[model samples]
Target: MKPGRPAAGSSHWLFTEDRLREEVTESQPALLPLDAWHRARGGRMVPFAGYEMPVQYEGIMAEHLWTRESAGLFDVSHMGQLVFSGDGADAELEKLLPGDVRALKAGRMRYSLLLNEAGGILDDLMITRLPEGHPFGEAGADDLYMVVNGAVKFDDIGTLREHVADRITINHMEDRALLALQGPKAVDALARLVPGVADLVFMRAGAFDWQGVPLWISRSGYTGEDGFEISLPGDAATVFTDALLEQPEVKPIGLGARDSLRLEAGLPLYGHDLDPEITPVTADLGFALSKRRREERGFAGADHILAERENGAVARRVGLIIDGRQPVREGADVLDGEGSMVGRVTSGGVAPSVGKPIAMAYVPVAMAAPGTAITVSQRGKVHHATVAAMPFVPHRYVRAGA
Candidate 1:
């Protein structure tokens, strides 16, 4: 499936099935900093998340397999890069997020969510605490770095400005570009440029410089592979990308392969697998809710979120393995035992890594256990599917000290 066809949340290009394409086509899409560079490399550019992004440079199947075996570089610059500074930034952010923001030590990255008053997810994001010496922040100032979905970044910024205390200054770093170098051989390719990055493990981030350009590098990615997400100035995007592509093991990957890779990894896409109607508990993302935050209960919709956690949500997000060779896309209706609709498939595709058609859906708790059989109706055709454990493909992250 084309990445543009799905509901894109920007930074993640969150997936949907059909409406996203229609939404992007209705407006003029902006160009990325690597726009001309992508075109020069034979990238098939498409309108996605209000920007012209490369869907593929080569075929999706080829890129998917290559990344699983070697290394793939993705232009994720369309995602929002936000910096929170001034006094009490961390504590102020904690009020809107369920994660224990105040306890996030410097140079560590945490996966978190921007939630609404009702515990509905506004957007999922990554937050990093930049230490005192990080070039992105003042020499002695610790700053909180956030990367939000590009599709809703402006809205996210507005929400932050409105919700957080005025003392916390939120700077939208629009001049920055983000890149992900993923796969088994990713570390090797990146270490050649910034040797210090080799020391960082999963969920950690640090600042480094290459030929005078400052980079905020993190040992993280969404593809269930050992990878790094690098943030740099937009002006340096073409040069840095070219440098990575020069490595023998690295290849330019498109959003199509990215969508498939994340699907196989069992990571939820914002607009599809997550939305305002879905809380972190129902989406099976309780990990983002820290223990301290749960007890303190200061975040938005804490009452509902905590209650749902204790009593269980009405619906659960579960993985599904569709029967047969034909794959189902998003918006497929999940059916109960008696043929009545019980839920809906949020994300579905042929998982290249798993070599099967896998999907994610919100189903009643009774239908969420693994091995439970469920029926699906797509385009009036009936298809059988079974609940399966997620990350259809095993993850290869380089854990701490590994």
Candidate 2:
């Protein structure tokens, strides 16, 4: 299985066998078995990430505010989970990525990118080294667990198989479901359901048993809050979710609010801020390139990535704070102080937390720094804007000893 080009009309550059399904129709909605769980809780289902997921239990704005103030439950089962293992697994993975996967300690997780030979990001993902005692980590199989974007799962899996075919084994965890519980009070709310999880530090993951159901819990989330992403068998997903929601601090949130939250957190969305044409450096994700990896230059596109790191890239991704109540959306032109077109907005919305319109765009490196005055063209109007620091809302990740 060699990595091949994505199918026609596909959003990603690659595809997986399991991801090839007929188009979703109103008569045959793509509902997960857990649909009954959401329906029982009064959730409104909508298509998202290629799966029919709950958009809200109450409402977007209410759930959004509650998460910010407390905790919110989100069904992210649509995310693709795959296991890669065999001899030289790390080495093979390095050939396709720019991250330092070999250095990741067991029980730790890392955010990395799958890159094409040209250094363009195919998809961003989270990889974790399963602990020695884990089921996936038996002798003769050195395994790496991955969670990828649902929209690109098929393509992503194909790419992985092609790159490491015969050299490694790839297993898609289709039996599992992913759930994200996020917000300032996420730890406190989850503690009552799964004790000791609140103590896990950012980027750390481990297996735990909750009421006889096993779960892979990671102390991480996209909301820039103290939160967790739990992976468990599909059969137990609703059971675990319902238990968490029983806490008064937890509410159900939707994709609309999820988008706004990540925007405010300065996190990049794959198809929007990241794609096959965007390299990590130009995407302002150079931090994800480990220091050792930069020095070693063993990963794919390392030559170009290292060169850009040393000499600096021509274009840089940046955050923008727009004036007025009107929001500037993706594809909006970004202009310099003199009103010359400089770039384009990749993602934007009225930030629920910031109480104003915010956006992210890529501009000439010279104009990417904070305090740079700029203009955004939206609906034929030029709006006053400025280059702002990311995380329109400050991150509140809980540290190990915090």
Candidate 3:
């Protein structure tokens, strides 16, 4: 919708010489197999996450709704996957993050954050221990797999390297392609192509061969569905994605739909919903802090985090379900009963699945409770809204033993 940006559904942008030059030369350090896939599929290539990627294929809205009803394959190869190895790896990582990395089972994963000394979030990440016989080898050798936001990959890598340089080995898996297959029908669709994929529960990961290519598969995603994120060699990513799209239930989704889907799920987008200015407590991500890690007080800004945990944060993130059909977009100001600004919308949109406008924002703790009345100001118009429970669409994660 922005000017100069390629219009939705037009693949003409993919043939621009600048795009080709960037993909072949400028983005060498972060290229993935999906790059070629996008070209072949008429993807409108653009610079994202330090790589040239498809912003949309068929269309954003159509791709978005299709993923909700069926399945959408997202090329998230731009995400940074770093391996940390050495003695006391878990303890070292815990010192930087407020999560109990040591408590994670070998095949399990945990959502966590990297924090600054002042309690600001540096980045949110998913940490998974390498499963037995995987490429990283057993845990004792001081190895851990970390996936971080692609937009901040360079900064994240630099910060990690600066702190743990002498103590561990950090391998950036930029050569790999990360594919997210998400939707209500994701599991069934993937099961037909990759046998045994459906058996894995949420947050569990394992190494498996897909069409003879070794891949790291995890039953996890950002779309609030029972899906999987697969990491494979970059060279084979296009081949693998093509195979997935051939399935009747799977299609390609773009960034616009990705944003809407996650918003419907009440999930936070790093730069928007979370940033260096926002603390994890105020962001409603306090659950990510483990009990042991909280008690140990070893991570950055532990003093502030613990204090907030005990006394409650002054501001808290909450969901807003608007009464009107018109969507309230990001940056909308939230007003209290007195028409005073209480907070600002971080992520907001018309949820296709819910058929209503929904938003997520951080309001003063006193006004964050469910059913609280609020107003959203968008382009000089006031929209009545109510604070609602998160995940406007209930999550379909397949928990262990579920």
The window of 10 residues in a row where model 1 has the poorest summed lDDT is 1-10
- Distance from true position, residue 91, model 1, in Å? 0.7
- 1-402 in candidate 3: lDDT tens per residue? 001111122221212233223223343544557666687777777765567777778776788789888999998888888878777678778877899998887878999999988888989999987754676434444468999998787798888877764778788876788999998899888888788988899999988887778888999999888789998887888778888888899988866677778888888988768888788899999899899888778898999888988999988889999887776666678787888777888766677788787888888999899999888886678999999999899888999877
After TM-score superposition, the amount by which residue 347's alpha carbon in candidate 3 deviates from its true location, in angstroms, is 0.9
lDDT of 1 at 204: 94
Q: Judging by lDDT, tell me the better candidate of 1 and 2.
A: 1
TM-score to true structure, per model: 0.94, 0.90, 0.89
Off by over 4 Å in 2: 1-29, 135-141, 337-340
The top-ranked prediction according to TM-score is 1
lDDT of 2 by residue, 155-269 (tens): 9999988887586888898888889999988989888888889779999988788888878889998888879999889888877877887898888786667777888899998
Candidate 3 clashing pairs, residues 3+ apart or interchain: 85-142, 86-142
* Residue 233 miss distance in model 3 (angstroms): 0.3
Global CA lDDT of candidate 1, please?
A: 0.86
